[model samples]
Target: MRPTRSVDYRTLAHLRLPPAVSDFIDGGSGDEITLHENTAALRRLRLRPNVLSGTGVPDTSTTVLGTPLATPIAVAPVAYHTLAHPDGETATVRAAGDAGALTVISTFSGQSMEEAARAATGPLWFQLYRFRDRDVTRTLVRRARRAGYAALVLTVDTPVLGRRHRDLRNSFALPPDVRPGNFDADHHTGLRHASPGHSAIARHTTEALEPALGWADVAWLRRITDLPIVLKGVLAPADARRAASEGIDAVIVSNHGGRQLDTTAATIDLLPDVAEAAGGHCEVLFDGGVRDGTDALKALALGARAVMIGRPALWALAAGGGEAVHHLLTLLTEELSDAMALCGRPTLADLDATLLAPATPVCRHTTTARREAP
Candidate 1:
């Protein structure tokens, strides 16, 4: 087969995968209520650009989890990257690193944490999905820290596997050939029996996924790793407050890319509440439905310290391998810069809630008609 030239990742979703795989990745379960909501919520927010403010050269530079980043964006964790490209996490790290963006390596990555770390030039964070055994979680955390990961992102949204109907209908399973090099077969024994569409590893590995995973667990996890711990998948203001009170480093306001929950508020819609709840006690990051730079800007304007993109990176990698991924990141970063200039916002700090307004007409229809009459 001839090699495909790099195309726009956002525009080239069609070229990325077979129909079955794409559906599994893109489609959510039941009515896909949350899946659609994540994107739909963005439409509800309108950008009210400032014209007179001299944007000059906008500064995208920011620090997330206390680490410097060229842009306030990171790659969210996804499973089985080898399914997208042979290079897997290695290629992902390089692309993200080259762009001076952070890469959050998934717990189920095709490459080991150490392998991905070696390929990175920019900062890296290890995405941790706690398994059944405390030792296992500790082992992974220790490994990530040893491998030079700057922080630990504890994925809190997935307790039980979300119903991904497409994957279920397709009986989606990683072909026997693809595996996460980081885990030994014995270490992941319980996960082996999980049926297609269900992640036994995710399910069997962590028994502490209940509501009991409160301040104590957060404190316990902190005891094990000096690396900053970021709690992912928080939408509730109360929970955000709890996270801040617990002395965690950051919170990733996400909904698991709309995979786990079915009817929750969109991550972006909930961002301001969470940020307010945080009260500047901790940094707030965002993920879910971030397809382009406008989406990134929307989250930033709403008070997200940084934003992460999930499926887009996989689609780009699958579409044309490493170079394609490079192009995809470049496109997004450039788009963000363009957006900032047009809005007359010179830096992320200049972004505020006023930059967002409802796109709908301000006055009622009756009011408009009354004004028009002679």
Candidate 2:
């Protein structure tokens, strides 16, 4: 049956995916505090609606890093799409293009970057992780550039894989039929493992990823690729400022979907600071806990050029491959349009901080009179 809502796909995915694969996609690091907090934080924000602002149908179209989008939403780079469906990243790209959104292909994608690019009709960006081999990293960057990807999204926060308890408990591994298409035979060998109570991907990451990666590598990447560079996983205002100073094309205010740091501030909570620090020097994109259009609207109001949907895309893919993914994007776009119309925002430009109202927190302390005892 076709799912009517974006979250309905999540339910369908949970039923379709194997336990380990589902856990890998759903679980977060440590106690999963930040994972839940991400959405909770977004829900806590109140939208201040303007009733009489006479506005027609709202225009949802916008651009990020100069790439036009039908809506201010993009599909985030989530590895191993083959785990969700056989077509993998190719299907994802197609769906994103059909929905008039961008797709950021992951470095650990199950489909080759070239294939993903070929499938994409709209803008595409390649998300990068610094590998231990600089030569291999260079090869990937060159491949992305040759494939005509619009930008290189450098994920900076993952020095090492986070301790996801669910993955560990499930002993997560790519099913035999699925493999990382980008890795050559020699590189792929290290990614295979059969250790119980451990994540094979985590072990692969530890051995293959560069833990000592720094800003200098960003310079190295710029010299190697002509494509625009975007720094993802930036949660700090200072880092956003530095990215602007460094002339980076954009910065994604993300916390790896709360998959890395367990108790870190929600991406939306950090968006304002990062946006303020960037100060229009570079574009600010956001990801993490964007489950609906209102959440995307809130992120934009706080100051984000666009937002990315991660798990929801995966859920949609698992539910019914490309078609479901397109449905999910459409739902988000429609919801955002509704939110904009109701908020009196005729266009993306009209969405501002003024549309937001501070959420009231629950107070724990209570006052009582002591005179009754006397």
Candidate 3:
């Protein structure tokens, strides 16, 4: 059945995906403390609504890094879309384009960069993971540039893949038919084998990704491609400031969806500090635990240029396909508009820190009045 809400899509995806695959998408590292915290922090923010203010037909449109968006939301890069649907990234990009939203395609995408670019009618950004093979990394960046990707998103958090317990127990590996499309067949052959008690992905990542990757590499990437660079997986205010000083185009304040470095602060909780450090130097995008438009609104109010939806896109894709993904985005956009209208914000610019307040506790006990007062 077609689902009308993001949570419904998640339920459908869970029902359809293999247990191991479901765990891989839904479970985070360690005891999943940070994963849960990401959403919990957002929920703790209370909206200070204005009732009498005449705010009608709120404008949800905005632009990020010169790219116009129908709403302040983008689809975060997720690997192996074929794990969700046959059409994979192609379907996902097409849907995003139709909705006038940006799509960040992952380096581990199940489809080739050229194919995904061809499928997109809107702006596209390529997310990169620095590999041990410098030549291979250069090739990927050049291909993305040639494919017309508007930006390069370098994910910095995973020097090594995080210890995801689910993948370890499930012995997760791409199905025999699935492989990373961006690389030569020989490059990803090791990714196809999963031993009984280990993750083939972890093994492949160990062999391919460079653990010693550093800021120097960011300069190397800049030299390789002219595309604007965005650093993802940054949580510290200092790192955001550093990114801006280094002339990076943007920074995504993320904790890798709490999949890496467990027990870290939530993305939304870290947003305000990171945004302040960025201080208009670069665009600040956010991801982690954004399930609805209200969540997006809170992020925007806290100083995020936009918000990215990760697992929800996969759920919607798995539940239906491109069409369902489009529906999911529309739902969030509508919710953002509703939140803006109800809060007396008639445009994205009108959403600021003033719209937010701390969620306070309610007291149940009341004091008795003295008879002398009468």
Candidate 4:
């Protein structure tokens, strides 16, 4: 398929999947105001162009936690890849490896950690959703580390699953043959059974997740593996500062693609504030509403070390599996280079808030060396 833009893949994915399944992938939490705003806020930020500065085709390579990326984009962790295609995380990993981008494997990944790791030709970070049982959570972490994952990305926003009306309307549940390749029958029982009018995903988390998951638990996680710990789902500047002050390696400024909240501030709007709060403390990454390279460039100028593609990657995976995902990222990086050259910022080092219109605030970065995984 000659899909020229990211939305084309989204359209193709909608056509490829069942209506209910597509909605499950596409829909956000109640009202979805936050979901729509995530992208809208980025579009609202006006970029100022610079005159000829001798900048040619821009260089897009950068490092996150000491790992190199061909571009500043990483594949965000989205659940149930096999639900899109049978290859699941294996295909996704291969695509990311080929593009020289990072892949964060969801705890609920459609394939086993071992399988995903084996398929990876690039660095991998495991996104952890801690279970009520410490042992179960610990096991998943050790398994990921053993599988050669680079870091642990603990999702802290979801104390409880949010209300997704689409799942309720569709009564979405995993097909019998497809289950998270990571968990055994004992811990993931809720995933296997679906009740009418309720999403199995909600049931699974309600039954197994730690609703009172707190900062203490984060400390506990820090104690066990010694992997570089990155906190995902942060939107508040105070929370960003706390994470950095507490010795967390990185914090992703995100709103869970508006899937977890109905009316929270858009990630792009919050990024500059969060970046400022965590200034020089830890690397600030971003993960909301990144559809193209220009959107990525805006996020970088706002002080994100990198941006992650969530639904966009899933849509690509659904439309054409791994190949589509690679092509989409390649296009995005090229666009980013084009944008950089146009803005007189030929390299990532040359990006700063001055490239943005006066309405936007500038965020600065000061990063220290990251601790390697043991």
lDDT of 1 by residue, 1-374 (tens): 23232124534655656665576557675668887777667655668787977778778898886688888878898877787778888998898888889999998898888999999988999998766556777899989988999889998877666777766666565555567778885655554455665544344434434433556667889888788989999899999998888888899999988778789888888999999999899999999877667789999988899999888788788877767777777777777888899899988888888878755343333332211000
Give each model a TM-score.
0.88, 0.95, 0.95, 0.94
Indicate the worst ten consecutive residues by lDDT in candidate 4. Answer: 365-374
RMSD, one per candidate, in order: 6.4, 6.1, 7.0, 6.8
Candidate 3, residue 268: the lDDT equals 88
Higher-ranked by TM-score: 1 or 3: 3
- Tens-digit lDDT track of model 4 for 93-175: 99989999999999989999899999899999999988898998999999988989999999998988889898887778887
Q: Per-residue lDDT tens digits of candidate 2, residues 231-283?
A: 99999989998889888999999999878978998888889999999999999
Model 4 spans with C-alpha error above 4 angstroms: 186-189, 360-374
What's the TM for model 3?
Answer: 0.95
lDDT per residue (tens digit) for residues 1-374 in model 3: 76766778888988888887788788788878888778777766678887877999999889988988887889999999988888899999999888878999999998999999988978899999999988888989989989999999999998998888889999998887778989886867778788888899888988889999899999899888888999999899989988998999999999988889899998988999999999999999999989888899999999998899999999999999999988998899989999999999999898898888645332222231101000
TM-score of 2: 0.95
Count clashes in each candidate, considering only residues at least 3 apart in sequence or on different chains: 5, 0, 0, 0
The lDDT per prediction is 0.77, 0.87, 0.87, 0.87
